[model samples]
Target chain A: MKQKRMQGNADLQKLTDLAQQLRRDTIRMIHHAGSGHIGGALGLADYMAALYGWAMQYDDLDPTDPDRDRIVLSNGHTCAVWYAALARSGLIPLEELATHRRMGSRLQGHPARKAMPEYIETSSGPLGQGFPVANGIALSLRKRVSQGRVYVILGDGELQEGQVWEAFMTSAHYKLDTICAFINYNNIQIDGKVEDIMGIAPLADKIKAFGWHVVEIDGHDTASIVAALSEAASTKGKPTAIIGNTIMAKGVPSMEGDAKWHGNTPNDAETEAALEAVGTNNRFKDFPIANRA
Target chain B: MYSGNKAMRDAFGDALADIGAQDDRIVVLTADLTDAIKVGKFKERFPERFYQMGIKESDMIGTAAGMAIDGQIPFTSTFAVFTTSLANQAIRVNVAYNNANVKIATSHGGVCVGADGATHQAFEDVALMRLIPNMTILVPCDANEAYKATIAAAKMDGPVYLRFGRIPSPVVTGADDPFEIGKARILRDGKDVAIVAMGAMVPAALEAASILAADGIKAKIVDMHTIKPLDENTIIESAKECGCVVTAEEHTVLGGLGGAVAEVLAKNLPTPLRMVGVLDTFGESGEPQEILEKYHLTYSDIVKQVRLVLKQK
Candidate 1:
């Protein structure tokens, strides 16, 4: 039991290091782009890092392989984190992270499947769409009898769209067991706190009532995310929803839990502070830093 | 109710089932309109391939797009109003934006849905779909054409919107008639005025042509089945010969077949044109014929439009 606990600690440490690296890369990407959702991206660093690091069965060389586990970014504004995950995982060239949201850049403001057809499971920016697409992928996977799972990320506020509930009902009704929804239960959206804007609280109960095997975890904790993902994969007879309770801009202390960082990129001083806080991911050393000195 | 004359949705559903038999990749999704959209045949034949998406049209579109991206040819069937109005953004982003192989096979287009009322009818479906890039819009003439179009849509790829009517008009086209995605079919030969029609309006255009023939006007009748990627070659050729053009449809004159044909004529030939359709008004809950006549979408209305365009020429 001691040895197993140590092994788990080491695993958590590795995931923790990777999450910091991803947050660092995401901060630089947004700082370079001059505009991106920094808060959600930072908040999702842990989820994305754990997903691409050890949880998902992905091959960067065979990115287009249909059998690979799919990541459908339903709430696409946080693509900075997804791009970081991809780049840091060696799925994409780390050097290209600087080209985010630029003219003719593949790393679009929103996740465009056509831009990176091989890696992007589905293109989505509009709220409440990626869930159904994920369900579709799971449906197709079920038909093919392939050992592939679809991991879809959702924002708490995106649940307001009536289509999300429809999608929730669809995955449950169809018994698409291969789908796992990771809900970014950050209270902040564009306007303000999610509850103040429109409460999607009692979110776990809502998803559970929709027939999903629901689990709540600290969305910023890599170990909890991995554990939740494992629990979701093992749960049978229905789809699963991991309600990840998270703070906005989780990595950077000054920005954490702040809604202002949602679409606001960090300035020069803030970039230095953010980089200092979440150091650099050794894998992405070649990635350029854009600080307006 | 008549032999060889079934609703366009029924014909489309039958064709889809047949296509599903031949091609294993064909899957059908309905937003709780199994009987209404007449996709019951496909659902019955391939229960595994069919998905009952409850009453969620938006979710159905996204799901179809999801399946399509995975190399499955998914056909989303529902009433035109729900599919276009409620889920138009879903179609725009998931299918059109992603260029996914999703066939949006919609029924109950226009005011032809009998007593289903204005809320259930659609006059802006074609317009809504046409605005999206990489979208292929097909407005088939009759049941026969709808069947042919549905089969073609399955065989073809990318984002496709095939608008089908709710009423059972005559089976005007042959079963084995040639059908392609963006190609227009010429039904009658004439040089007086080209009557470009789509969906239920084709039969009216044919009758209108016959009426014009009695008065020494050799009107050309065309089944402008494929609205988007409008067959400019055929329209221009017919316009040059006919000197004037009468575009007819059961939809609004704003953007259906009329808008497509007029855009073509206005750009290339500058032919005298008159659009015969609902004049930007909501349809009422009445008999299909009463509503059609009220909206000036009947054969007589086509005749008047034809004469009106001829006078312009």
Candidate 2:
């Protein structure tokens, strides 16, 4: 029991470090691109870190294997986090991270499966669309009789689209328990705070009403995120919705919880400051030189 | 080559169920129009493979695209308008952009879905689907051809829009007739003029050919079913042989089959063309035949367009 607890703690620490690196990568990618949805990407780093670093099982050599678990970024605008996770996890070449959002880059502004076919499961930038694709993936996986599960992340504002509800119903109606979706509740969208824009109040009830096994968690807590994913995989007969309450632009102290950072790239000074705040990893030293912060 | 008059939707259901039995990967998704889309047969046969997705076209499309991406050949069905226009976002991004091997087989593709009103009638489905890249648009001529097209779509990769008619139509293609994707079939040979038609309009074009034959005018009948990745070689060859072309469909004259044919001719052949379709208008609730005639989408309309194009030639 002691040894297992120690291993769990070690894994949590690694994931925490991973979350910091991912946040730094998110900032660097957006800063280099000169424009991107920074807030959501930063906010989603912890979940992405937890998922890529620990939960997801993929063949590093053959990433598109049929048995590999699918990671559907439904909130595609925050692809910087997804791209960073893929690179950091060694699933993709770390050098390719520089080409993010650049013209002709496989790392498209939105998660386009056609652009990065093996990595991205589907093209999803339109809010409320990715979850449905994830549901479909889960459904297909069931039909394929594979152990693969679909991990999807949706923006809180995305729930406003009626299509999300429709897809939510589908996951339950078909009893596609293989889908473990996370609602990146950063409380902000392109417009403003999610609640101010369109109230998705009583979110747990709404998702439960839609027939999901709801697991509310602190988005930044790697342990909680990992636990929820496992809980989702274990729970049968219905899909799980892990509502991760996160701070917008997490790990970047100056921009945390600020809706204004939702779509803005960090300036040179802001980038340096943000990099320091997130504690950049030595693995991606080429991205931002040492002592730059 | 006429087998009998049967609704194209019913034929699509039969072909879908038959295909489902052959391939375990084949799945069918419906948006509460199970019987109307004729996918009830599919649901009955492949109960596990069939998904009654409720009245959610957008979700249905996205889910279908997902399944396709994961190596399942998913055939999503609904009224043409719902999938084409209402759930167009999913079609554009998930199916087209992702290039997922999804088949959007729909019923009531044209304004001929009488009594369903303008909302259900999809006059612009072909045009909407054609605009998207990586989409293979197939408007099968009749019930028999619809079955063949469904099977063909299953064999092909990437996004396919298999548009079918709601009303019963004469079977023009025989069992032995070739039904390859992106290949147009020449129903009748002619030299004076050509009639390139798709969906419900193919039967009308065949009738027009016989009518023109009586008047000593040999109008070639071409069933240009696959609208996208269109059979340009066939269209140009036919236009070159006949000197002029008349494109017909149960859709608007603006940008459906007519527009696709016109674009091809202008770029390659630059042939004189006349389009016989709904003239930039919405359909009203009425008898399918009556509405088609009023919108100039029948045999007589094809004859009228052929004469106009022949004059230009």
Candidate 3:
């Protein structure tokens, strides 16, 4: 028991360091692109870092390994952060991280399978559609392969789409224990507060009613996210839904929970502050030294 | 020609059960249409693999796509109209986008849905499915053909839409007959005109050919089942052998087998063609036999179209 706890703590620390690096990558990439969703990316940084760096079992050498567990970004707008995490995880080169939103860049406005194998399982942009696609992946894995997990992340605001519930019901009906669905409950969408824009209150009860094993956690805490995802995987005979409580603009003090920061590019000064907050200056070391820009 | 013995929907279910026994990864999902689409057999044999989505077509397709992603061959069953109209987004996103291994098993296709009328009859099903990219469209002629098509659909890697009619029209093809995707079979050979048909209309075209053969007109007949990746070689060859062509189906004239054949003919040989199908119309609630005659989807209608096209020659 003592040894297991020690190993868990060590994994969390490595994830935390990677999370900080991912944050730095996220800030610099969005700043360079001049157009990208920053708030959700920052908010999801810790949760994504935990999945790629610690939780999900994937191979850096082969993306389409038949036995590898699949992680799908249902809310694909936050590809900026996901790209950074993938780069840090060695799934892609760290230099390519800054090429986000650039013409001919593998990283695009949305997560596309063409960008990098294992980085993106499906191309997603339209809201409320990825949930079912992820479920399909899980169902396939459950039926064909012996042991594989499917993790999908959804924005809280996107839950209002009826298709999410439809997929949720089906997941539970089939008792898809191999799939884990995460909702980044940032409480803020592109327009305004999610409650104000569209009331998604009692979200936990709603998912529980659909027969999913529900877990509530702090989205910014790496350990909490990891534990929740691990627990979801361990639980048998039911699908898992983790309702992550997150601040939309989590890292930067000035931008926390600000709806305006959801999709806007930070200015030079703001970018500097954002980079400093994450405690990284690797942004300036560019061109051949770090050709990702 | 044998008729009124078995519905294609029943054959779909029986074949699915047999396929499930062979391939454990094959799962059968339906929108609360287990009995309606005859998937009860699959449910009885492989209870664990069968799922009923409870009248939600969108969710049914969405979940089936999910199953496909894991390398499972999923057959999502529902009425042709609902799957085509209500669940098109799921089909386009979940199945077509990633090219998931999903088969859309649709029953009650075209005006053969009889007493259920326009609401149930799926005249535009072929049109809707054909418009989507990377979708294999198969219209099985009878129970035997539906059985063969069901097995073929499971073996396909990408998205597929297998259409089956409600009425038991004809069991023209033997159960052991060979069936291959994207290939058209010549049922009868003639020189005056060529009749290209699918679904319940294939046998009608054969009957029309016999009548024309007696008149010494000799109309050629081809079963063009796979509509999307149409057998252009067979269609063009038939058009070359016979200067005129007539395309028949139990669907709307706009975009069914008729439209597919016409599209091929227009681009390839520019043959003079007449289409025998629902003429830009919706079917009404009546007996199955009455609906076929009323909508002009009969052996007589096919013969008339054959004569009309030959006149253009």
- Please give each candidate's TM-score: 0.96, 0.96, 0.89
Name model 3 segments beyond 4 Å from true. A1-7, A10-13, A30-35, A61-67, A98-108, A113-119, A140-147, A230-237, A253-256, A264-277, A281-293, B1-4
Supply DockQ values for each candidate: 0.77, 0.86, 0.54
lDDT of 1 by residue, A1-293 (tens): 00111112227777788888888888888887889999999998888878877777777667766778889999999998899888878778887788899989899999998899888878888999988998888898888888788999999989998889999999999888889998999889999999999998789888889888999999987778888888887888999999999999987999998888988878999998988887765544647645534
- Per lDDT, the best of the predicted structures is 1
Query: lDDT of each structure?
Result: 0.87, 0.86, 0.82
- The residue-by-residue lDDT of candidate 2 on A1-293, one tens digit each, is 00111123328888888888888778888888788999999999888877777777776777777877788988889899899988887777787878888899988899888777888999889889898899888888888789887888899999999988888889888888888889988788778888899899899999999889999999999888888877887899998999999999988889998888988778899988998887756644645423333
Off by over 4 Å in 2: A1-10, A280-293
Model 1: how many Å of interface RMSD? 0.7
Local error of candidate 3 at residue A134 (angstroms): 3.3
Candidate 1 wrongly placed segments (more than 4 Å): A1-10, A281-286, A289-293, B1-4
Question: What fraction of correct interface contacts does each candidate retain?
Answer: 0.73, 0.88, 0.66
Candidate 1 per-residue lDDT over residues B136-184, each given as its tens digit: 9998888878888888888887889989888888778887788887788
Candidate 2 lDDT at A55 equals 78
Which pairs clash (backbone N, Cα, C closer than 3 Å) in model 3?
A95-A292, A136-B66, A136-B67, A140-B70, A141-B70
Model 2 scores a C-alpha lDDT of 0.86
Q: State the lDDT of candidate 3 residue by residue for B166-269, as single tens digits.
A: 76666888866789999988877788898899998888888888888888888888888899788899999999999999988888889777788888888889
Chain B TM-score (model 3 vs. true structure) = 0.97
Docking verdict class for candidate 3: medium
- Sort order, lDDT high to low: 1, 2, 3
Q: After superposition, how far is residue A1 of candidate 2 from its true place, in Å?
A: 27
